[model samples]
Target: MKDKKSAKLNLQHKQHQNGHLSPSTFAKLLDLEASWDKDQLGDVLHWIRQIVALICGLLWGAVPLVGGIWLVAFLLISSGIVYGYYAIILKVDEEEFGGHGSLLQEGLFASVTLFLLAWTLVYSLAHF
Candidate 1:
């Protein structure tokens, strides 16, 4: 009986490990930021936006003519979404140190610089 119970517990743990949670999407849809008591939302937004920007930078290189416009639009839309989610949905107020503007600015700067640097490197490599 003890061995059977241990096996059952192990099976439950394995099932939990393999659970299809996808909690990020669920949190977004439900605006579950209220669960966090601190002001780390801005930081989270910053990192998320920066990652998205990096992906956009990578995609920027593979597009044809007038690709910059598309990239700019995507960046704007994504940033807007981030802002709306944090300010409206999450109800996160403006913090003194890492406020929404600061986070957005930092993220946009990093992403744009990354995109430019990547583009420059690729251009140089292709030309040389």
Candidate 2:
């Protein structure tokens, strides 16, 4: 009985691993993960856009500012930096759909970038 149960479980696991869950299995057709079938600018932009937006949100929310205006400008510039860093490091020629950089590689870039930004703000304010 145990052998039979194990066999059934193995078969189910193999099926799941095979990528056999036809893309159209869901009638509603919710295509969440960006399609990797095509290598294009749209996909690369999408990848960088997501991470940059996240960081922008974090900076905007985390900072307790007295400013009435510069907030929007700061987020915009940060987003630009994040996007630029990725484009430079990844090499614009490579299609981001099938990216090779590790989380540490990308995360390090982001961390260093945000750190510099924070340091700059701190120094600028310290003088003011």
Candidate 3:
């Protein structure tokens, strides 16, 4: 019985370790948005953060022109970070926009995917 319990506990711990953030931790992150009053500036800031990943996609396209590979790399990493911040914004959007949190997540995912794709295209096109 003891061994079985230990094994079960270990498995549960492993599952959480594998990128499985708990709702409490995720909810704590979302708390940041709660401080903002549902108003114009708060909405503006939310939009800006949500668009960071999209901005990275645009930045990656310009990398080839000026040899801004480092800059582009920085933008890509920053975009990922901003997407995380936007996740918090999304939670707030749930309250403000009637549970449309996935919209921001989708935008971030799409923008990150396109950013990487654009970078890959630039490399292949320039080389080939």
Candidate 4:
């Protein structure tokens, strides 16, 4: 029993020294139970939004969706996904990230810019 326990601890220590997450920590993250520092969480949310924006932009361009309705749809879809991720999936505390507003707004501007650029470029290239 002692040898087994020591082996497990040694493995974990080696993983940490190699900059790898321990098995337990990896499991927690997969289960969305891991607590993330503010900056790390914020950056994760930002990248998530960016990815969503890129995919949505590409789809909208391919489908040739236009007008205010599409814009509204983009906003709804992007924000909704981000909201669901942090609030439902991660179950993070809203107050920790300065309420829902700041969390939702992270990387929003850059994402929108990316979306518009992708939309216009794809639409012009493919449709026109």
Using lDDT as the measure, the top candidate is 4
lDDT of 4: 0.82
lDDT of the candidates, in the order given:
0.60, 0.45, 0.50, 0.82
Q: For model 3, how does the per-residue alpha-carbon lDDT over 16-84 read when each residue is reduced to its tens digit? A: 644334344445444654343333223433344445644554555555534556546645565455445
Decreasing lDDT order of the candidates: 4, 1, 3, 2
Best-fitting candidate, scored by TM-score: 4
Relative to the unseen true structure, what is the Cα RMSD of model 3?
Answer: 11.3
Query: So what's the TM-score on candidate 3?
Result: 0.33
**Candidate closer to the true structure by lDDT (higher is better), 1 or 2:** 1
Ranking of all predicted structures according to TM-score, beginning with the best and ending with the worst: 4, 1, 3, 2
User: Model 1: per-residue lDDT, tens digit, 1-128?
Assistant: 99999999999865764423335534654464445423245446656666676666555554431446766776786688677766677675658445766646645666667766665565455555
Query: Any residue pairs clashing in model 1, and if so which?
Result: none
Q: What value does the lDDT take at residue 69 in candidate 4?
A: 84
User: Model 2 over residues 9-120: C-alpha lDDT tens digits?
Assistant: 9999767744333333332123334232322333334445445545654554456333525445654554465445444533343343334333213333444456446545
Q: After superposition, which runs of candidate 3 have C-alpha atoms over 4 Å from their true positions?
A: 32-59, 62-66, 69-118, 122-128
Query: Cα RMSD to native, each candidate?
Result: 7.9, 13.6, 11.3, 7.1
